[model samples]
Target chain A: MAQRTPLFEQHQAAGARIVDFAGWEMPVRYGSQIDEHHAVRRDAGMFDVSHMTVVDLAGDRVREYLQYLLANDVGRLRTAGKALYTCMLNEDGGVIDDLIVYFLDDTHYRVVVNAATRDKDLAWIGEHAKVFGVGVTERDDLAMIAVQGPQARERAVGCLPPAIADAARDLKPFSAAAHGEVFVGRTGYTGEDGFEIILPGDDAPALWQALSAAGVTPCGLGARDTLRLEAGLNLYGQDMDESTSPLESGLGWTIAWEPVDRDFIGRQALEQQKADGAPYRFTGLLLEGRGVLRAHQTVITVDGEEGEITSGTFSPTLERSIALARVPVGTGERCEVEIRGRRLPVRCVRPPFVRNGEIKINLD
Target chain B: MSDIPGDLRYTKSHEWVRQDDDDRVTVGITDHAQGALGELVYVELPEVGMELSAGDACAVVESVKAASDVYAPLEGVVVEVNDALADRPELVNEQPYDDGWIMRLEQVDEDELAGLLDADTYLETLEDE
Candidate 1:
């Protein structure tokens, strides 16, 4: 039996197509996935992302524990409600999970991790947290909803409690604030301005309804995947997993290398790998012709270096196929992707194919 | 539940067949098939002159979720492929029976048409699935 979120009933009520995803019964789409994708790009759309795990950490050493456990430094969080995106790593420098940590106070913090990696992420964090005596509490009683698009903030804010709404409206990007039990973070996977709200599970349905009434379209995982792909966000299991390092997954910028003396998990291996020169470069591929690019497809660069696509989808925003790939270092501007036994030409470019309803990359 | 025209034929694979006249037949996926596929992004049609056997993987219909092969319900030489689908693949989702028709086949044996399921039988197969 798969687990269901608090919003499962609401999903069914909306005539969504339900599917099993990572041990949970989740909505894949309400109607046309392309329409949902366009709603997020052009207007406001909300997703029931309650499957994500929310963990609260409390202890005098909580900050220090996060600083050591994650690849990105939490020391950069200078204010309450400030959030930092970081990757938890094994000693071998391979990514365990990527998460966002929000500082609430010196002794209390919150982290949201991927739903698929819930068990291992909790176990890994728990095992390592013992040394620092941090109290790791999983907040399964909470539900998260991401409301996104150009008009997302405006429409979603109207549905929140007045005080929480006012505070959330003032939040800058990558910051969060809590009012009573409701937590609002001005961050999202879609490359659009929006809010990720975490509240008590029981309140989810009403809020979901309110948001819908407020003109925020109810979306699902199918639209979420495409929106995130277009935004150049990495899906943990597909883009990088326990076997891959952040350096080779276009996450070098997420690594905090400063404070040379700080010995975070995977520091030594990552430094060694950095010194040895990372062999693979993460890149984005745009198909020059018809046909969709899919994962595990072989990519052959002009120099004949073989690589593979990590994640691929047809961009509803761009009206073309795009993908994230791991190719050899120095792979140039052009390559060929083997789709259905045919090597079709593709252009190598940076990701973020679309942002804020605007095209970001050079389509020409 | 999807529309099953009483006059046409169906395969377990969810393709609908319409006998055009003497020996030719027009083929397209069923409404249930298109609904399962969601909105299509691209349609890979077979070449007009391609030869196929029954159950041969013929054309491809790609949605945002996954790509599915449209199989041949009978052995025949391809006579025409839907060109409108090249620009407007959503036609399959909008009109799986009419304008969304994928291909036409010539040289099809009349026996194969008799073997295909009619509306009532195809609806039963969908229920079993």
Candidate 2:
């Protein structure tokens, strides 16, 4: 049986199109996916992301353990409420999951991981945490909602408790602070300024209603997927997995290579792969024709190198199709992707095809 | 559930055909089919002069989640295809019966239409499955 979020009835009340995603019954879209996508880009939109799992690491050695466990060094989190985005790796130096970790205090830090990888991430953390002696507790008592866009922060402050409303108003990007039972973070997957609110599951519905009344549109997984894709954010299973290393998944920048002496898990394999040079590199494709790019379609460069698209979609802001593909490293500025036996020309460039409600690509 | 008008004829593949007095048959996906496919995104209509076999894929409908092929119900010539859907595909999701009609064919082999199901028969077929 599929699990439901605390705001399941709230989604139903909005006439949402609900579907089973990663074993959880959640809204894929409410009314129109395109409208919801435009809402996040133009104004404000909120999503019930309570299906994601949050783990709190509490102990004297919590920071030490995170530094060793995550590919990105968390040592830079000197101030409380700072958040770090990193990928947890397996022995093969492949991404087990991409997650966000928030440093709350010297002894306490919180990590939010993908819902599909919750069980494995927990077991892996438990098995490897013995040396540091940190206690890992999953926060099932909490539900998370992400309110994102240019106007997101202002609207979300109205729903927050008065004690933390000032703090929330002043919070910068990639920061988190708590007021009473609510934990609000100024972080989001979309390339928009927003806050992720974590509160008791019992208060989720009322807070959702309040936020909606404040002009925050209720978005769903459908809009979330397009927004993240347009922002160049990687999905755990689709972009990279246990077998696909981050070195080839456009995530090499996320890894901390300095202080090579620190033997993080999968360091040796990543080092070797890096030294050998990656054959297939992740690239962004801007479609130049009428056809929309899609995953698993064959891509052939002008020089005859073969590649494949990992994720693709129509960008609402760009008014065109964009795709992410693993292509031969040094594949030049122009490439071609085959759609239904028709070869369509595409341009290769860094992603963020649309950001901050504006088009980054010259769609001429 | 949206009502599938009794005057219309349906195929097992969930397409509805309305025969006019001029002998041109207007075609659209049944309301049930549109309900099964969530919000329609992109649509590919057939060419106006194309000759189609009974089971040939004449058009394509895409939703945000997935894509589906709309097969031709009977052998016919594509007399007209909906140009409005090129820019506004959501018509299939909102008005699958009237404004959302996909195409109209002039020369349909009426003999092959017997294999298609009536409103009650199609509902019964849906129930048996």
Candidate 3:
């Protein structure tokens, strides 16, 4: 059976373009996708990201279990309401899922995992929690809404209860705070300043509607992908998977190597990969010619090494084709992409074609 | 908008062709095709002076969500392609009938053109679907 979010009826009221994504019914777009994309970049926009799974871990050993489970050190989240972004890996160093773990208290921590990877992530965390005595409870009663942009916080903070507005207003990036029963986190995937508000599932529709009335454009998954790609964020299935490791997937920085003695899942495999050095690196591409770069297209390197484009699109902000590809580590600034048997030249740069409403790579 | 134009002929694959005064023909995807695709982002057209046979793949229209092929209505030499498409692919979505015509054929068989559907017939086929 297809699952519906708390805002399902509200989406129907707005004439949204609906599609089935990962076995869940989702809105692909409300109206013009480009308009929503720009709204988040310039003004404010809201997204119904309630389909993502939220798990709350509670007990005496909760922090200890996360330290053992995540690749990034969770000890850095010393203060309450601090959020940490990290990847949980399997025994072979392949990423299980990249997620955000928030420490609400010493005994209460919240972890939000990808909707598609929820089952595996829960089992992995459960396995580690067995020894630590941590209780992992899925928060099905909660639904999340992300209001993101320069004005996102202003609009969303006003819609919530008065108690939350104060603390939520002061939330630093990568932080979360609870006021009453609402959990407002200063985090977002759109590379814009915003909040991900977690509230009771029954109250989500009313809140989503309130924000709609406030002139914050309601965006969908289509705009979300473009926004995250423009911000240089990696999608799990395309950018990395179980067979791929953090070192080669441009996620090495997310791995905490400090203290060197810390043994997280897949640390041994990552150490071996580090000693071997990276043979190929993930890169960003800007098409010099006319054509949209798309996934699975072959990227031609000067050294004749084959690289595959993981994610590509015609960037609305840049008005040119941009893509992320895994190429030979030495593959430098210039390359060609095969589009319909024609090898079109492109410029390769560091990952992330755009950031914070600014074009990171020069097109002209 | 009117189902199909009376003066033009249509292929079963949804291409519309108009015969010119000099035996040349202008071929383009039907308006229905563009509306279904929704927001074209890229176009891959066949080269000028390329030989094509009837029902041969002539061009590719790529929307953001999917890609579709354009087939030749009649066999001929490709005299020219819509060069504007290379820079402005969304023209296919915005102006699919006129400026968005995919290609022009230098020589086309009249017999092949005669077998295609007339305006009324094409509109009836659309209504059935």
lDDT tens per residue, model 1, B1-129: 689999999999999999997789999999999998899999999998999999999999999878899999998999999999989999999999999999999999999899999999999999998
**How do the residues A1-364 of candidate 2 rate in per-residue lDDT, one tens digit apiece?**
9999999999998888789988999999887787899899989999999999999899999888998999998887888999999999998998999999999999999999999999999999888888899999999889999999999998999888899999999998899989777999999999888999999999999999999999999998988988988998888998899988998899998899987777788888999999999899998899986556778898898889899998887776776788888999879989899976679899997887778887776676
Select the stronger candidate by TM-score from 2 and 3.
2
Instruction: For candidate 2, give the lDDT of residue A152.
Output: 94
Give each prediction's DockQ, rounded to 2 decimals.
0.86, 0.42, 0.43
lDDT values, one for every candidate: 0.94, 0.88, 0.86
Model 2 residue A110 CA deviation (Å) reads: 0.6
What TM-score should be assigned to candidate 2? 0.94
**Per-residue lDDT of candidate 1, residues A1-364 (tens digit):** 8999999999999999999999989999999899999999999999999999999999999989999999999999999999999999999999999999999999999999999999999999999889999999999999999999999999999999888988998999999989999999999999999999999999999999999999999998999999999999999988999899999999999999998988899999999999999999899899998889999999998988899999998999889999999999989999999988789999988988888889899998
Comparing 1 and 2 by TM-score, which wins? Answer: 1
Per-candidate TM equals 0.98, 0.94, 0.92
Estimate, for each residue in A1-364, the C-alpha lDDT of model 3 and write its tens digit.
9889999899889988788877789998887777888999999999999999999999897877888899999888989999988999998899999999999888989999998898888888888888899998998889999999989999988898888899998989899999756999999998889999999999999899889888899998888988888888888988888988888788999999986888789999889889989787888888997777888899988988888898887677877778878888878788899987889999987756666667777777
- List of chain A TM-scores, every candidate: 0.99, 0.98, 0.98
